[model samples]
Target: MNMMSMSKLSLLSVLLIAHCSTAASDLPKDVFILAGQSNMAGRGGVSSGKWSGDVPPECKPDPSILRLNAKLSWEVAHEPLHSDIDVGKTCGVGPGMAFANEVRLRANESKIGVVGLVPCAVGGTKISDWEKGTRLYSELLRRAHVSVSGGGVIRAILWYQGESDTVKKEDAQAYQGKMKKFIMDLRSDLNNPSLLFVQVAIASGEGRFVDSVRKAQLGINLPFVKCVDAKGLRLKDDHLHLTTMSEVHLGIKLAHAFLTTLK
Candidate 1:
């Protein structure tokens, strides 16, 4: 090769290395996906088409914690984590921020890496909506991919859903199979057979089939899947969604599960 061409190749390699280093510094090393329905999107302090704008100390944002925005860009995460993603609902305090904060604190204590949360939950979505070919599922995978494109390692998926599926007995009865398939498909598509899952068992539901759905959620005996029961958490005035404090509590529980079980 000519001397000029060799010089150009060396310069290109140098610039590429610099760019990659910058990107690595910008992204977090540890990542988590938060996916589910309204409770996962968060209904805490949300009423009459508005959010109360209340944020608990445990759910506070930190410099070490980042969220993948709707634009697939990283930003400092805060409460109402799904405002842009869960557009249809009045987003409020959810377990996400609390989960991230708790995880960050615990990770920091252990000298672990930073935390990145991918919020992809849509309010009131059914399990059927997250089937492999569906829009919700596609979006979830898209966001997850974008999250890890910057070199972030996806540690686990934090799921809290199934309220929508409780409206009918058929949906409730089919919940187990659908949920297992959902987990399997996500793992397969993500190319991580051992991807950890921390799922919150439903505290409340739309209809009379809450127990059936909860039973199905707790019955999934996968290798890296762990279920955290939310049955005792406090619900809001609507008698359906969890209260703000309850979301914080759930976040703590999720962090505990992630630390003790999934680690």
Candidate 2:
């Protein structure tokens, strides 16, 4: 190639590298994965097929807090945080925004920069649906990798699920084992053996085996894991999902667990 052609090619390469560097630098420095089912996807202030459109102060959107949108890009996070990711579900308030806001407030003294939440929860999904090879699992891992692909660091995964598992006696009985495997496989895939996990023990379920599932949740003895009980949190009229206030409380609890225990 002539010097003119080579020089043009070198300029193009330099521009490409500069563009990539800028994009990577724009990514959040602290990333957290939010995964689970309906409750995790959020049902607060949601009844029938609609959300009340009310966002509590604790769960308000913050410019410093970002969410990995369904398009796999970062945007300032707001309430109904899972709306885009959960798709068909009428997402109201989830622990994600509140949790992120709380973390940001408390971590102001630390060097914890921008906070990014990767929402991967699907409403009404069972633990079985999130097995290593399942769609939920794959999407979750994919989103996770994408979240941190641009030089961001995955701080932890905030989990709240298992209500679906309470539907059957056998499922409840096997909850602990499945849950443990899920956590292990996730950490293995993420290649972070010490990745933090803050799980919310179920407060209500669609079936009779609520206690059994909660027992399994609290019974988990894995390292770098913390379980926050939602036993006394208020539920909605349906007696299945938490109320708006309860979601806020749960978010605070999750934040406390992460800040005080896991951090």
Candidate 3:
């Protein structure tokens, strides 16, 4: 072979090797996207060993889903409390742990190992704040893409927002349209038309808009989307957040929804 031909061949061989290596890397067999407002962000106190048996060695808890050199690490999701904010004395755990545990349990027969959870929940965020094509949504999509690129296959999205939108009656009707658009955009961005969405209905409360938002969330009839009711679950004194026990209960409830999808 001539020098130029030999060089071209070598380059092609290098490219093929790189591609094979990436393909061979152990990507997450399952990936879960956890997103929403304050409740999803979690307000309950942190408990040690809450996820003792189920946590995969590779999975660690980090608030912010920070990516470095195409790899992800965890960081605290909240800091520099705003002036108007009230930091609940107790930190409430949300559904992420329970969901992971459920996956481990259900996958016991198959023994699927190391489920990756990408939690990007922010407190006090409105449904409108999750708008597609916006900076916030763009960041979310970017993180998701990176996670997938890093060998994580996104299997589902867990949403727990709507209180803010529900409080404003005028915005309730438009929620359905907004939610539909968000789902479509999410699927398109992720290139996964069948992405599973497990939504948590706003728990029963004093607010008038809660029921409206729940109804709207349930109204979206897209395939692979299901809503889990949190009405009966006991919430915190603020009448918004879930207590530790309630959080665990909520998590189990979410796990049930996820299992249903698997079936």
Candidate 4:
């Protein structure tokens, strides 16, 4: 090739490298994954002008909290954090923002770097739906690996599911085993065997096996895993989801569990 053509090609390669570097630098180094069912997707009432009811100020968005958007890009995180997940017609408050806010507060002298929350939860989903190699698993795992590859960190995965399993005795009976396998597989795939896995016990449901799911949740005892109770948390009018306030509380609980693991 002539010198003119070679020079132009070199310049183009330089520009491309710079652009890629800039994008990777923009990614957050601290990220949390939010995964589970409706409660995790959240049906808490909204008060925003764009939504149905009211969302308290505390539950509102914070600049410090960031999320992986539909385009797989980092953006300011807000309620209904998992909109792209198709969990609801409109997003409402979830524990993500709350948990993130609390994490920032407790980061101590070390400044909390940019926080990225990866919302992969699908409402009404059962534990079986997230089995390794399943569609949901692949999607979630893909998102996470992409985030990490882009220089973002995978600090923890906050899971709040199990309601759907409450509908069947067999589902409930096998909940513990399924849940244990999911966590192990998830950590293994992430290549972080000691990754902190924080989970919220089934808090809202209407089925004969509700308590069974709860019992299974409580029975989970894995290293680097912590399960927070949610059985007594108040629910919304539907009685199948957590109330806005309860979600906030649950977020705090999750944040505490996650932080404790870091110690």
lDDT of each: 0.90, 0.89, 0.66, 0.83
RMSD of 3: 7.5
Model 4 lDDT tens row, 161-235: 988998889999999999999999999999999988888887766577888998988888898888998878998
Give the better candidate number (1 or 3) by lDDT.
1
The positional error of residue 182 in candidate 2, measured at the CA in angstroms, is 0.5
Question: lDDT tens digits, residues 1-263, model 2?
Answer: 99999999999999999998886676799999999988888888888889989888898888789899999889989878899988977898988888887888887654678899999999888999999999999999999999988788998899999889888999999999999999999999999999999999999888999999999999999999999999999888888888888888888888888887533
C-alpha RMSD between model 2 and the true structure: 2.8
Top-lDDT structure, candidate number? 1
Candidate 4 Cα outliers beyond 4 Å, as residue runs: 1-23, 46-50, 87-89, 109-111
Which candidate, 2 or 3, would have the higher TM-score against the true structure?
A: 2
Worst 10 residues of 3 by lDDT: 77-86
Question: Candidate 3, which segments miss by more than 4 Å at Cα?
Answer: 1-27, 46-71, 74-91, 204-206
Spell out the clash pairs found in candidate 3.
Answer: 43-91, 43-92, 44-91, 44-92, 45-91, 45-92
Candidate ordering by lDDT (highest first):
1, 2, 4, 3
- CA deviation > 4 Å runs, candidate 2: 1-23
